[model samples]
Target: MHTTQTFRHVSYLWDEAKALELAGNEVDLFIYRSNLLGADLRLTNYAGGNTSVKITETDPLTGQPVEVMWVKGSGGDIGTLTKAGCANLYVDRLKALKNRYRGLEFEDEMVELFNHCLFDPKCAAPSIDTPLHGLLPYKHIDHLHPDALIAIAASKDGETIMKEIWGDQLAWIPWQRPGFDLGLQLEKAVTDNPNLRGIILGGHGLFTWGSTSYESYINTLEVIEQASEYLNANYGKKRAVFGGQKLENTDAETRKARAAELIPTLRGLASSYRRMLGHFTDDARVLEFVNSNDLDKLAPLGTSCPDHFLRTKIRPLVLEPADTLILKSAEELKTYLVEQFEAYRADYAAYYERCKHDNSPAMRDPNPVVILWPQVGMFTFSKDKQTARVASEFYINAINVMKGAEAVSEYVGLPEQEAFDIEYWLLEEAKLQRMPKPKSLSGRIAFVTGGTGGIGKAICEVLLQNGACVVAADRDRLDDVQTELRRQYGKDSTITAAIDVTSTDVIAESLKQSALQFGGVDIVVNCAGLSISKPLADHTEKDWDILQDVLVKGQFLVTQKAVEILRKQKLDGDIVNIASKNALFAGPNNVGYGTAKAAQLHMSRLLAAELGPEKIRVNTVNPDAVLRGSKIWESGWAEGRAKAYGIAMEDLPAHYAKRTLLNEEILPEDIAKAVLVFVDGSLGKSTGNVLNVDGGVAVAFVR
Candidate 1:
């Protein structure tokens, strides 16, 4: 093991005053310690480390203090973990399970036996690492996959290197899949050396501990900082890193532009089995490695640590496009990737065949989760935005591990069969099986213009609830709405951006953000519009041009630009234009708004016809008299309509409802619901169609 407070590479974020405040509260302090360790990726990747503290708790039945271990639960990230996410188990019971441990093969049964040791029934389920912490004698324990430690852990002479760094204070152990047996090994290794600070798990990660939570936290960072300093020194001594850079860096703008163009196609190919969202980055570290001569050689050898290997797959697919970040054409690009994907699947199948045990789960999706293009940055794909981002981050960690290992010593990855076994582990398969069923719009991405407005916000919320990631685009950014939605639906669910729909350049930038933000747009809602209720006599050229520019030309430009990405993805898509009932029904003092809406309605049909052959669906939802919670209504359109009808402004809802065949009041949510029907796959076969949400207005019914 490598153990310090002073460091150059890692941050010392511990708050002494806060620590003093939490001193008496062990569990909260433990959580604080865990959060600090997880806050920095250098300590561990997201969802990649486990921390624990053992404390005496009053036994409900006996009224006696009993030793209980609190550890991070399965499927929880340490950075965001709370008390609710911790599993509490009787330490004595966990230790007693050793008698029932039949053998190494029977370690599979230990996970089930963990239930017998639960100290709290409602606590989150214990992770497989529970025993790792519970079995140790220390009051606090932290097992982390820090990049600097991993770099040494991944080297061929990792154990010898550990001895060189910490000599007698820290210990070393060979690689073993974590479970009861590995936990036992940890306990014995520490038991044999009472003064040891920690142990290095070869080709895996580091294990550090202390008699106190704060001590454990500091020890973990000290070890990482020492290793980081060592690696930095060695890297400085090297003539070059990663056998020297082989490719030149592309300019940021060209690289980003090319990344956006290819991301949709990359997403299309990655969605070979099921759709996966993508994340792209050109972080300095990522650029350095991808542009290295060793990238092709090191990439195929795969990630060394099990956590890194699990998320990124054993190895990433390396694509050799032109050094300029340009491909010959879309057709050729697809053909080349199709072949590459097929080859990757075959390789994965062969790996599974060679490593399967009698009870191995059937092979998972064989497509590569991480892709490397030399001049371009890395692309990572998964079922959601956060996961994709984490995967990419993990790959970058892997890259750093390789860089460190190669800079000082030869890098090593897990044995192919070992990686396969871990990937297909029956326990992992069960965890995956326990995951909740995907929501209706799961794996779908959406772009909503005017998304901060009442109707648009409702649509974004509904889509988020149904599992779609959304990009909320408006003429100006809605900072509060974005922050609130991210807080509610998770940071991955939606992003907010300002866009001018009338400018092709702005619309193009919006689509680029969409591609980068959430792979590509799967659905688009043209809901940004303002109403000018004026008669032909009152309507001026400015009124007509502004109305046409925003309502008609704006929707056209947004759709036209977004379609380029939709086509590149080669995936089914939907566009919902929010036309009004005024487009169909003649009303006094509504010429500008009605005429522009009519043009918008026809444009949907026109786009549907043009894009239908590419599996893109364009539709319109005509919402009439949505007086409540509508921006247009709030912006005087309601007062204008009330005056034209000779009624009170507040009475517009009743007036419009009375005019409807069903005497029903229309609302922004009703319009939002109408938009959902078009994109939720329930009406997959119906496109180039109009759905009138006017509470049964006879004149506005679509033909």
Candidate 2:
């Protein structure tokens, strides 16, 4: 064991903070180093860990020096820890708040007291574990659920093994749900072992403290390094023992094709609930673990630590190996995935029933947070993409921990009751309760062709408003569209691409970029079209070609590329083509535009029938007179149509509106909504259908 430790003095990260005089040198140094600790995924992941420093400052109210602990505040990641992310709490008040607990059964009451103990009302909510940090007598404290240390601490003989590894230098505290009682217990343990440098909370995480921020941070790394070395020596170096069989003739494209054939069934099953969203990953180590023959035995052992249960649940939903899937046909494969999901849900319900005690909260949604597919790797499900990504990271880390622990002994996870306690613990439950209700199409990604145009931009806006990340693609002027979309939906949620929908190469590249940014698209809106109103005899071949390329050919190429991405993601998808009412009702000198739209209508029906087996639905929306806000009307098309009617350009919109039986002015927003009715899957069993947005255009009604 490389346990002989050396302390290194870390350099200043906030040299500018001292120069700017933004904060005291000590406070700024603490903030800078805390971010470094948070950035290391091996140490702690995605806001799951926290750091704190004790500082004495004169109280403005009392003109007396008081000790305050500046801890990482709630809902803040340590990787981006700012001075504002630290919650300044009075240590004496926090200690006094503990005496008022009175052994309350409900956890929220204790959380309320922690809030009252905060010295600065402007400070963000302190971490729930603030009490534990406060009770320990140290100038600086760091707490992390580092995977290496957690693997050793999460096993059945974790305390015994930790003692043998570190001797009396490290103290062991048995598993306790994080709250007031746990804080009191930790305080007692520290008092009993006055000379201890750090402590390990069984099935939870590790804690290290020192007289300065650098000392505490380096101490954390050294102990984690030692734990890694210990595991490597005892359990075989570099996870060599857990290597598994790799698929023959399998490459990245092959895996993606297999996913398209396999994942839609899983996605279909998961998306049966409006709240569930799915994500797929073929990350190298995850693929190896899922392909391993021993996965059946090891996968169900649960998360590496108790903290992870809130994110991943106790165990993942595991399917049969990829080799088994390869032998089945597409239909057979889908049936098999559905059966596995059904079995997983039933098993989850049974586990919840068994784990429930009288005082325990109701069982969670019973959906597996992580789904382990054999050859295809893993699919993680959550309410949205951000949560799914976080859960995915946690599960991957858990796999690493399990592999290391397996090398030492048969790895053990926390028992059923304890897992339930943490999963339903009020602090964790509060986090979920704080989340806003998801929008109807939340977690779904949509791609809109001609997205810079009036109706197309409206479609993109509606989708973003309903919580879908949008990729807005257009042939030109995309930078302006990008600005509007970013202003409305945030830069992270909106992507803009310049592409000619008529070109397959450009379409493919744009779809690829969309997938790279936001997983894969669930909805494809084909809104790129053009109008060339001319009499059949007088219309030039160039007029016919231009209209066909922008409408018929453009819609075809964009839909084909989107379908490829949708199939690869193996998720339910919608393709809504915006066809004009001119397809249903012929008007004078409209042959070129009408013929192209009519061809699009028939194409939608044909594609719908072909793609339905893959669970991809195709539909069309027709609008008669959306002249009020359509770029198609503003850009010379309306003027040409008015000339055919022998009317002024200003009278065109009113003339078209009056032609409708209801005399309602159709806006681009109206057409966008009509497309959404089919795209959002609200009409679950309806497809190959045309929805009309022109208010009472009886002539344009489907014949």
- Candidate 1 off by > 4 Å: 1-5, 321-327
Query: Among all windows of ten consecutive residues in candidate 1, which has the lowest summed lDDT?
Result: 321-330
Q: What is the C-alpha RMSD of each candidate to the true structure, in Å?
A: 2.2, 5.7
lDDT of 1 by residue, 344-415 (tens): 989988888888888888788888999888777889999888889999999999999999998778899999
Which candidate achieves the best TM-score against the true structure? 1
lDDT of each: 0.88, 0.78
Please, what is the TM-score per model? 0.97, 0.79
- Candidate 2 runs further than 4 Å off: 1-29, 56-65, 81-86, 102-108, 156-168, 193-195, 232-240, 243-249, 408-410, 452-458, 471-522, 530-539, 553-575, 580-590, 598-703
Across 513-553, the per-residue lDDT of candidate 2 in tens digits comes to 56545556789999987787777787999999988998999
Pull out the clashing pairs in model 2. Answer: 264-570
Assess candidate 2 and give its TM-score to the true structure: 0.79
